[model samples]
Target: MEKNEKNEEEEADEEFEEDYEIKILHGYENNYYDISKPFFIYSKENLVNFEILDSILPMNTSKNEHKSGIIECRYQLSCFLRLTRDVTEVTNNLNIQQFKYILMTLKFLKAVENKNITKLLQVLIFNNFFYQKDYKLRNYNLHLIQILNSSFFTQIDFHLKKNIMSSFLNSLMIRYDFYDENLIIFKNSKELFDYSMFSEHIPYKNLMINNFDAFCSVENILRDSNVLIIFQILLKEINIKSLILNNFFRHLNPDENFAFLISKIEIFKAFTISNYKIPASPFFLFCLIVSINNNIEYLRLENISYCRLNLRGLLEGKKLKGLILSKIGLTENASLINESRNVYETIEYIDIQGVFLNHSIWHEIFQSTNSSKIILHFNNSDIEEIFINNLKKFEIQKNSVLYLEIKFNSNTLPRGFCNSLIHFKNLKTLKLDGYIIYEDTESLLYKAIYYMKELECLVLCQNCRNTKPYIFLLQNSKIDCLDIQSTSNNNDAIMIEFFRLHKSMTRISIKDAKVSSLCLKEIFKQKNLIHLCLDIDILPPQVDQESLTFKSKNIHNLDLCNNTLKYIEGVDILSKLYRVHTLRISKCNPPPGYLSKLNKKCNSYVKILTYEYGILDFDDLNRIGKLGNLLKLNLLGCKFSGCSFFDLVTSCKFFKSLKTINLLNSNIKMKDFQCMKRFKKLKRAVFSFTEFNLLTLKNSLASLQICKLKFHTMLEDSNYNEFCLYLNESNIYILRG
Candidate 1:
């Protein structure tokens, strides 16, 4: 018994030690590659930077063409305006005139950013650089293109038309920071011909060659020398800015074909490679990155972090700007960072997460960034403290670092640590996460927060079991923005006091807190609460369901995610807000027939209803259809097998109101939907993982404007040819399984 106790104690200490500091962080996976979870929160959606209107909006010509151009722009703008009036319109119609759909969407988004029409849409679309909206938009376009390409290529005898391929590539090129979710839709050489032509029209800058989705190996995919020729053509034509060869190392065959492509495309502005395993000497993609993207400015290496390459050969005369050496370290006295200091003083951004750099070594690395600003991300509070304390050692000019984000792993920072932050008076943003605090932690920490008088945004998160209400500590804070996550709401008084203290906060994320419906009433009282997220799994019994309907006219977005609304009394409270524009509900199975009662009681002005993963019945669909203003209805992974999908579609009277009916991972039949009369209002019907027969069905899909179908059963050569022939004659798109 004593031995077991000792072993358990040792294990606990080890766990505590492990959590305190992360030596090497997979920041890439956390930020971009995690396909399991949604990339952004439901309320705070990351959108594209439509502010690049100058680039996307038709360029101005001479004064002679200005009037005619203005007329043309207005004409184009009107088309976009019509599309944005409802989400259904854009969703339903994208397949009909795909080029025009993409072009108008981009142009219309410029107006949305400018708030030219529809005040509700203008607010939802923000083009903030910090949000990296352009990246998200590319991902959306890529996913769409993946679906289109999968079906479109199967129809062609040889390859895609240049005009068609150019139109799609142009849509992908709008954003400077390009990413395409790297969905390699090309199946054979014929499709590769279309992909090869992409750089001919637009300035192809950013690219991720392979996104190891299901296809981990490049074995069967690259059948011959045809792909290599295409790669060579792309490199010679386009000036590559950012190149990401992630998920390529292990799968890349150690052959002359792979080596030839590597040797061909050698220079880029920035390069990133993550999750690569070192095979034989043939696995020289890493060497190719250093030698090739030869004009390298920003370089990031994750997972397989270390290399025995000669640092002098890689860094000697290069003007490198940013370095991300994650989860790996410098070997021996060959500290590459120190060597670079002689060439360039400081790299603009150095993100070192999951790796422990001892204080002395870290200080040397910190001193080498540019004067404009040095953006650094550390996952350990100890490392963060080391950074905070070592600021004086580095000769960074005053106000050089205008913002600093300090993220904590587990350590509740020492009081002096907070006090030390004020020295960097220009610090505008501070974020602390995962650290739990108790009553005895400190009141002085509040003074520490107060000292950063220039701080504009503060995010405090504590969701551990021992997390206590710590709102009183913010009494001295002048920060206007707060995102707090608490574990317990035992003290209603404390929560009320918290709202009272920061009553004017513009945005907030309250999740897993002991906040009940009554506490939410206090939250609704905030005048500037434009965005409110309620992610509680269960509301406490003390919640006042009969809580008075509050008038929060400013509130535009409401996200009720992963929370049970079955017990909540005032689920209809949202109906009272006329300004509510977007409502997202996910992963909550309510009691049968609850949606009908709620829809009748509430008249929510929700324009977009994004529903995912709840066994919704036909009545639920009927109830949702009853919403007077619901424009777009997106159903993902929800079973509709119990009731015929067409029965639900035919029953929906808001055919004009709901423009898009996208069903992914649900059960539906092709023949039943053939008699889709009411579906005329729907511009598009996307069926993914929905069981449908394409072999026996004699269904005419032309009635439903534009339809998309994904087949399940593998097709024989004759069947594939027949399927292509059938779809080519019809408006329906058959996406490959």
Candidate 2:
């Protein structure tokens, strides 16, 4: 009987994941207080002074801390509503541990009842624990069905019903083996779906389903209604990157509403299918193409995100507007030379990250892309031989300009390519990355620029060999901006000369430039140079600290990234620029003390600041709160904790002026509608690659009906019919890659 009991509980453990690790207070007991902690928001009767709380916690408080020996389920109910117990126990004495126990009891109640069950079952499903042995189960004593099914829950709002139902399922998943299988509530649902079939679970991330490839598709669980529930949840998450269909098509029921599924997934406006994966046959490809051929415009193929693959032709369904084809490794021996030529004449943009083709295939690709912008990234040194004769044939499209992003693999470029560039007098922007270049190009590249009077922007990125181009562009081109990368001591002389002619140059950016601290003095001499970015080699870390103080009076924008630094002397020097409105310190981990120096010196003039890939603490938040004119903040990919980031924003006066914010790739919690509730002037926000959740997120955020940013596909719920209707009515622009 004990063995049977263990077996039943093991089965229960298989279906539900264990609870997440509990949160411990960040600071130690003594360190936590004396600082004067605020009272819990829900329990505070009024704003009262806290004489410091106690110094330590009792051990094993994970066990209930209530005065009674057992956990009072009624206490858990109060916390479910975000409420807490009385503050009568606030100890003025530092020695007392009473207040600590008060917090522990509240935490215990919060943990026992606030079981995010849906998330837990997700772990069990993916980890494949049902097939394992000796897994134990723990049960919460509350009868969830009795409480949720009561008249009190029945008359509640429909969304609340869903939440309650979800809570019941979460608890049920963990306690299934412990509960009597013959219990009244263990019967069939209104849809005749049997609960005894096992509890449904959905993953937190987008469902990464694979049969041979999908770990979730085990033992016919694919047919369960839970699969649809997970899909429905994913649709609401708005994380539509790519939905692989390999396992999807293989195990799907023929009678299923695939059309309805397709209709609900209207967020997908781009598609890619590669022949490299599992060797998909032409016949199956044809059927797959026919099924999805109607809606998408942007298409790419193969392992192009990382590598390359075979060129798959556009079929008879939808005409692609932009196509990304990479590493189309066609050989003379291949039979499908004629098969790959299904080009769409209407296509406008083409991006080839890598390509290896003979003359005929190369000609066909260029002919296919007659769009306004064509970008190609190639590492092959022999591209000149492939296009030497053809370069001259390329026309300067009327009213169109040429832009080139050239990286040198060898000093020897096709001798004719740079010579041929001059023929297209319509070249407007030229960006050359010569990190690997050794040969001098100032004569040829500069002479070409001298002739293209239409040239407006010149970016010399990495190993910019000679100074002549900067000096020559002064008279030859209608240039407004110059972005130079990786300057040497020789390039500093080039900059010295360029400054003499940069009175009309409004923007300048130089990265990894090995120049002295005095270069700022020369840079500040240019009256019209409003924006400047420098990655100087600040050696001896505190080079010229006391003597070299920042004093740029007119320069308005500054960026200092990609360099190692030890102090704020450079920023303190640069902060003297009264007009400098945009500042970015990114891709480098400068100490927070360095940031503090910047905040202290330039908080008033700097209107926009972007910091990335660094440790972010409340100090940074507090400093950002001091920037009086800050209009935009892009804190992308920074490591930060605490749920009250936005709460800080609303309370601080300096952050009131913020108009645009990019929190991409960050974990942000707090209601979207409530967090931005105070930023009335806030018009735009970029939250791509972010996961934000709150109690009111789905309801309140979606209800913003007129989310001035015009949320058309913003709510990418998995119902396509409704999405399509919204799309038809929406005039809002949706950006796609």
Candidate 3:
């Protein structure tokens, strides 16, 4: 009976897992904190589709947190809205839009439930999260004072008033002490925490006084808690896996609270500190390394100038699985070899980039490591003949190394390095960058790949070698992913020969290698290709009588950039890729009626279409409207000055499923912006670097329920004030240049 019950539970879990998916959709071209371009969380099964105003906010992944934030919101809000005493009836009346707002609002409520609003304000101020938006408030300190002295304060509940006063006072104290010590306005606002300000609310008079007294005692500590408090809150609340400190510890010293917190909490699985300049004392660095618990698996240091020898203590515990050092300055190399020999047996991954290491030290570390499965990434580092000879002789890395990337500063490999690559028999992924492999070395590299029976992905970038090395691996190897970027000119014939020979690569991205139409024809014949990205110049079609037909049915994404079509053959080639769901064409000059042809071929297949830095006339816009399945339309930097925006909107009337439209740096008229309200499903719109008129902006504010709107860097400075005023009236203040 227990076994039968276990089987039933497993079946139920499988069913649930198949139906649930939480996806995050980022904006077209915006950073995390831009409220005008917030990330969207979409989930169909959970009824949790909403916009997170701050994209960098930690996602609530724990079951308890998710249940409390979303499920509790539904429960409490339903209870409050129960008119007929039926929760089902109240919930049924609410639409998906209403549920979105409810979820967004309750997420904020859950945040402020445990954390004081004042503390959050102080944290944002210290972390510079609000530096961009604070200026839009126009003397934010004065604005806060105006709001506090308004009649709105007299309307809240007595307990709520006391809580507000306490939070406001605490927030002001932190700003005055830490954020800007020289600001006279904050110094003046520091006098508002007195007993006279709260005498009207006698119920919590003594409580407020005690709170103020407690805050006063910690005033000195708060001044030194610049960004440490942010990290403390994150470490306390979230189970972070990686702790990254970039450009940190310029001259600041850690307080006692931070030291205590670091000692108490379990160390992160991975820790990284990069771009550090100031040299810290050896003892201080030793203490910091000793504080980390044995749970650490990865330690990364990049561009650090301080305490290179002291950082060797980071490998002391013999528990780390990965060590990544990039552009690191080493004062003493002999000590690092000794430290690596102790911990190298357990390390599974090693990435050393731009670090000057002697040949003996490299040979010693490489010879000592004995991990079962290892990944080696070496970039621009010294790997002399001794190390390469050792690799060929000992073969310690042969059966263990699964991933290897060898990138050199010059476009040339060390002598016999390509021959030694054959020793990594278990390599599943190999990347060789900045290497101009000649025909002989290229043959050797392909020969090495032939021996790597487990190789699945091969990437060769910035290679100026004009050779068809992939031809050697076509029949001998079974690599499904091939990425190549050539810096030499006129490799179309070589590429054409290779593509004609191979048809097994499931993903192919070749950049900066100009290919003719004939070369593209050969690439399209690969039936297993799922993604094809070519950023080369597409020359005019060559004389060929053979039909140019696409053979791949699995290709869902086709990205073609910097291609100028001088003939209709290129358009015909693109029209043949009708199976693609996402088609991105940038900086391409398509012949007239290109969209009409695409609409006829891919009206039902394409869902996400991006055409940037091209001309889109009225007829083209009308043809785009016929693509009924388009979910996102990105026309960034397209010349539409000659086309009427209102006509485009009215012609594209079948965008029922469209959710996002980005028109950044486009010639869009201000009055025609209100016509976009016709697309009811449109949720996010970006019009940055465009002109805006206040009259149409007013109408757009009233009519459009756009969850994310961006009008940053408008063209005309004359209308900036009025445009900003209208946006402020609508409470859409998340703007950035």
Q: Of the candidates shown, which would achieve the greatest TM-score relative to the real structure? A: 3
**Global lDDT scores for all candidate models:** 0.48, 0.45, 0.53
lDDT of 1: 0.48
- Per-residue lDDT for 627 in model 3? 75
How far residue 279's Cα lies from its native spot in candidate 2, in Å, is: 5.8
**575-691 in candidate 1: lDDT tens per residue?**
455566676667765544445444343345666777777677777767676666565677776765356566665555566555556566655456455544455445445555333
lDDT by residue (tens digit), candidate 2, 485-543: 75456555555555555556777776766665455445654557677776667433334
Query: Candidate 3, after superposition: displacement of residue 453 in Å?
Result: 3.8
Ranking by TM-score: 3, 1, 2
Lowest lDDT 10-residue stretch of candidate 2:
183-192
For candidate 2, the clash count comes to 9
Q: Rank the candidates by lDDT, best first.
A: 3, 1, 2
* Deviation (Å) of 615 in candidate 2: 15
Candidate 3 similarity to native, TM-score: 0.53
Model 1 residue 98 CA deviation in Å:
24
What are the RMSDs of all candidates, in order?
A: 22.1, 22.2, 17.8
Pick out the ten consecutive residues of candidate 1 with the lowest summed lDDT.
185-194
